[model samples]
Target: MLTLTATPVLDVEPAIHGEGPTWDAARRELVWVDIDAGQVRRATVSPAGVVAEVGIHPGGGTVGFVVPSSDGGWLLGADGGFTHLSADGAATVLLALEGEGPAAGTRMNDGAVDPAGRVLGGTMALDETPGAGSLYRVDLDGSVHVVLRDLTISNGIEWTADGRTVYLADSGAAEIRAHDYDIATGEFGGSRVFLDLSSDDGPPDGLTMDDEDHVWVALWGAGQVRRYSPAGELVAVVRVGAANTSSCAFAGPGLDHLVISTSTQGLDEAARAAQPDAGRLFVVRPGVTGRPAGVYRGPVDALHRAE
Candidate 1:
């Protein structure tokens, strides 16, 4: 068992709904989102680090996740669209989901790049209505395809190290579903419950897989992050300073450190006072390496087209 410590890396006023913590190894930085704030934030990490807030943006609308791109930038999931947000802070739309009509919620939510370098993101209804959500795959050719539907609060997505299995968490469902993944064809099969939290654990929020194939999940409203073996056995629990812990990732120069993102959204004055670091970013050296973040290899360059 590894001892966990919560170090406040970045202190911000408040994040309404923070999620999607990704490590950009090349730049030694950590990137995340504040959904209700409609912003994406980056913080630089150093050996004797004092986490500095590097950048922030309107994020088009309720940005949920941002991943490094093959072209040396980022792919940002915004309100019903995938956009290109460069390291220098310029933003451009790459794909739009306007055709989804009334079913279309406010914006996209949690997302991650598959081993094949394609972007896989899920959407949620702004109104928090049940079944008003969908998961999508954005191909390199700028095509967006709905891969799953009837989801409420689509969140916490990751793939196994071998790229043969996909783990998706539906917070509302209180279940983490696994699917046999095909990297060559980008298809998912053999869907079933890998871990069910409705009976014992809290709602699953964000997730990350370690080098040993263990799944680490953040439990929203439970104030903890749990590690589960590949076969769905609970291994460890890393407590957080807040109940609204949203997402987590392994970052730092060596990808051995775990960073968690929490939220203060919907918390009243007394509740906020109880958890003063609710929206702050926390880090822990878990003594385990994590898989590098997959890059967004989609049509991000099209954002730079000449007028």
Candidate 2:
């Protein structure tokens, strides 16, 4: 397998818990979330991995992920449900996943927009409670449906190039599963183990697929992002500076730059000192390019002003 190392982006500030890196092709920007800080970040990066500009928007509370909207607003998994951040800095709840508020101690976690423009988001308990999470799908018509359940930490959602296969990271289960996807109907069928990382490096966190259809998964606490072939073979490994590497995506004008997000959450002072680069962003070129992230096509105007 090939090996590479990532370098920190000096121009970017560190995040409390950074996750969900995505390349917005229409805006030609890199977007990610700082979950613990409830912030959505956007940046303009160059081919050589230099961050030129950044914009931060509030996500109500504890955002799981952020995706560009068909409208000028932003759609994200936050606090109790999916929220919309308007272009003018207004925030709205949009849709509540649970009841009026998040169930007792749970919050929305990582999520992504599927190829069919449907939003697939998940929820998890605050204390890492096992089997306390469920994945939810938001259709274009403003309807919500439960997709998968019995998950501990529901994270990382990505689809193959053809949009026929989905890879989901059940982080608390230490496994990533592949499911047959129906792009036309947005239904999932027969699931199988994609990568059993229970005996390997670390739990899979976020995922992205390259142009060649290989899946790249960020291994939380492993300080690495691994590239796996279509047949589930490890092809390359990108070493990161922080153990809490949360997520990654390919950005830049050509989509060839691999941008990674890290977290300092859960680390004590000593542990934070050991990984001084924790909570910072890193980048590396893996000699591969990724496709643009799926944009959310749901009804943006369905959002009501947050009370």
Candidate 3:
């Protein structure tokens, strides 16, 4: 059992949609994105302040998620394609999602790094078109693999500790699905329903797994983050008070604090006023630590590694 507590805002700077909070353990900082505003922000955990910020959209698209790269840069899943954001603030196009711009107005959204460090990013249609999104994985060998297709608002992705199971949230479907993962062969199968939510509970948004392998999901319109066991049994729920909780990540010295991102996107004036903290970052600790993401590997690690 976990001790659920009230979540408090960690950062005061609200965003149109604050999301994808990734912990850079090497720097002891929290990195996240203001999606609609097209900015990536970072803050030192101990110091509890915004350290450095960069806008990646000027290079041509909005960033959905960012993971630390081996070369001290970041691998960003952007609207146009994937961009490698250099430490000097340069956004280099790594690959394009489409030959031209997204035809269906789709762009990368929530994502997670596989145990091999390859990035698994999901896309969502800007126009909210059903079945317009898909799941793609960028390999170390410089290859892009489309893992799944015909999805709507492809979001939250995670794998079990052993790297043999994958849990993905298809927000449009309002459910999370699990797949059998082959860590050695870089393949996956056996996707089945893990959890489904009703309109009242809110749609599943971002996801993360704790040290115990319990899946923690942020409910976009529910104002809460819930945890479930590997068997998909609800374990705990933490109230965040924000209607649109986008994503969450474990942070702080012990990685025991669960920090969540919120959003004001799509909210009318009345809705925004009702939830003033709608687009800020919040943190709460339920006496659990988090798994650190693996730094992305390069060609040196090969697409196929030893089992």
Candidate 4:
């Protein structure tokens, strides 16, 4: 397998816990979340791997993931549930995830916009309690549905180009699961183990797919991102100087550069000191390109009524 090293993007600020990295094709910007800081950051990335901050939106509480909507607003998985952050910076809670099914102790985690324009997000307990997480899907019409239950820590989420298959990482379980998906109905069929890392490098945090259909997964504590073939063969490894590598996305104008987000969330003082670039964003050219990220087409006007 091929191995490569990633370099930090010196222009960006380090996030306390950077988790989700997404490419917004419509605006030609890179969007990601600093979960612990409750911030959604937007930036412009050059093909040569330089990042310039554009805007920062504060979500009141922990912001897990953010996706641009076709309605000019942005939808995000925040502390309560799916929220709408209007273009003018107004916050509207579309659905309250806690108290109905998940307990108040739980908060939304990583999520992604599906090909059908719906948003699928998962939740986990703040304290990382086992079996206290679940995945949910929000349709374009503002309806919510539970996708999966009994998950420990729901992290990375991605889908095949055809939207017939989905891969989700249950980090606490140290495994990623692949499920048969239906874009027409936004439902999931049988799911099976896609990648088991219980005894491997590290727990899977976030992941993305390239044009070749290979999945690249970030290893939380292993300081690396790994690429695997569609048939589950290890093909390449991208090493980062930071041990808490969180997530990655194919960004840049040509989508040729892989933008990675790291963290210092669980590191001790000494460990944090050893890795000076722990929370900085990193980039590397992998000779591969990814398609434009999925955007949420859900309506937000009705969300205000629900709030």
Candidate number with the higher TM-score (3 or 4): 4
- By lDDT, is 3 or 4 better? 4
Query: Candidate 3 local accuracy as lDDT?
Result: 0.78
Model 2 lDDT tens row, 1-307: 9999999987788999999988888888888889988999888988677876468988967999988888866798988688888877577887775542355688898888899898898888888889988888888777788888889999998998788999999999999999999998788899999899998878999988999989899999999999999899999999999998889999999888899999998899999989989988899988988988888997875632222
Clashes of 1: 0
- Lowest summed lDDT window (length 10), candidate 1: 298-307
Who is ahead in TM-score, 1 or 2? Answer: 2
Once fitted onto the true fold, the runs of candidate 4 whose alpha carbons sit more than 4 angstroms away are 100-103, 303-307
Clashes of 2: 0
> All predictions: root-mean-square deviation over Cα?
3.2, 2.5, 3.7, 2.1
- Candidate 2: clashing pairs of residues: none
Clashing pairs in 4: none
Give per-residue CA lDDT, model 4, range 1-307, as digits (tens): 8999999977788999997899988888998999999898889998787899988888748889988889776888988687888876677777676453234788899999999999999998888889988988888787787888999999999998878999999999999999999989899999999999999989999999999889999999999999999888999999999999999999989999999999999899999989989988999999899877798987875532123
Q: Candidate 2: where is the Cα deviation over 4 Å?
A: 99-103, 303-307
lDDT of 1: 0.81
True-vs-predicted CA distance for residue 214, candidate 4, Å: 0.6
- Candidate 3 per-residue C-alpha lDDT over 1-307 given as tens digits, one digit per residue, 9 for 90 to 100: 4546555564357878888888878767677887776677777665232323333333235778887778776777777567777777677776776622366577888777899888888888888678988888878776888888888988989889999999999899999999999887668788789898855479999999999999999998888889999898888888887888888888877787788889998899999888888888888767778976667775322232122
TM-score of each: 0.93, 0.96, 0.90, 0.96
The C-alpha lDDT values of all candidates are 0.81, 0.87, 0.78, 0.88
Between candidates 1 and 3, the TM-score winner: 1
Prediction 2 TM-score vs. true:
0.96
Please give the RMSD of candidate 3 to the true structure. 3.7
